[model samples]
Target: MIRILAFVLTLGMLAACSAPPSSTGDEVQRLASEIRSLGPDIDPVEAERAARIAYSYSAQLAQEYEITDPPLVHNAKVNKGLRPRGLCWHWAEDIERRLDQEGFETLEMHRAIANADNPFRIDHSTAIISRKGETMRDGIVLDPWRYGGVLYWSPLTEDTKYEWVPRDAVLEKRRLDQHGALLPYVSG
Candidate 1:
């Protein structure tokens, strides 16, 4: 009886640990696909319209790709090296440009190193969209050719800095120039 109980308990724990995180990725992707399916006459040039289109597209990509966590340097490194084309930045840039051409204002965001002494250095990029009359602001962190939506209100003045990276590390090196490198920096 004790052995069986222990086995069951272990199994339960494993299942809990492996459970999927938030479904934000799927939600984002679904929204994006819906927007893409809209009629061609639909103006993607208006800020409001563009915001809707970009948001939906971004959400769909997130859902389809299963990217739940905020974008990180390590995620970019692993996905870029292992995934097809190994061109994470290219995907991000293309998305941002596309959204912009469709009339949405886009901002390229970089995660600034929080600490001054740390040796490792890296940065990630994303697109921010501004739509009139909509109180909810949306931002996407692109890495691994995937966008992690940081859904919130517009003009994010306080939450712009990401807390995930270890602070105090001096910028040891910039990794963007390296062939096939995913992150902007590779720490020493």
Candidate 2:
């Protein structure tokens, strides 16, 4: 069942990414509907453009960073330097920057720190979009790096791979810098 769902999502993601950017209400409504399917209150036209920009930039980063299959772990000796830029966080930043430019009227893009409470203190980072001023706990996790460049997104609370709580402590409530680069915890 999970495989089927992933397949469907991948197809939908690729289709949305490939479609040319549009401002038509119909196109916007369609794309917005799909994003909202995962639970977000975004303008469809804005959502369409955001996805297109994310995908396009991901491709560019993949090439520029020399990304390879089985994404490189950030800070790992194998991932150091400009050679293999496959860190999942890199993917997150790429998408974050693209969406930041779109600047949604009804939504705010967040640089979410996932699994901030891990025993090892490691956190996985990703891009999130939610209604303006909503909590990170309420955002949708848009993680393109997890699957080696395939965009994986779902409601943060419902995300299966990691717990995307607001901060290391649920009460901390911190936001990532607009630069969107975490000093550490870039592991996948």
Return the top candidate by lDDT.
Answer: 2
RMSD of each: 11.6, 11.7
lDDT of 1 by residue, 11-32 (tens): 4554344333355545444434
Each candidate structure's TM-score, on Cα atoms with residue i matched to residue i, is 0.37, 0.61
Tens digits of per-residue lDDT for model 2, 45-113:
666666566556766766676555444332242344646555656667777777877767877777766
Where does candidate 1 stray beyond 4 Å?
1-45, 63-81, 85-91, 103-118, 129-154, 163-188
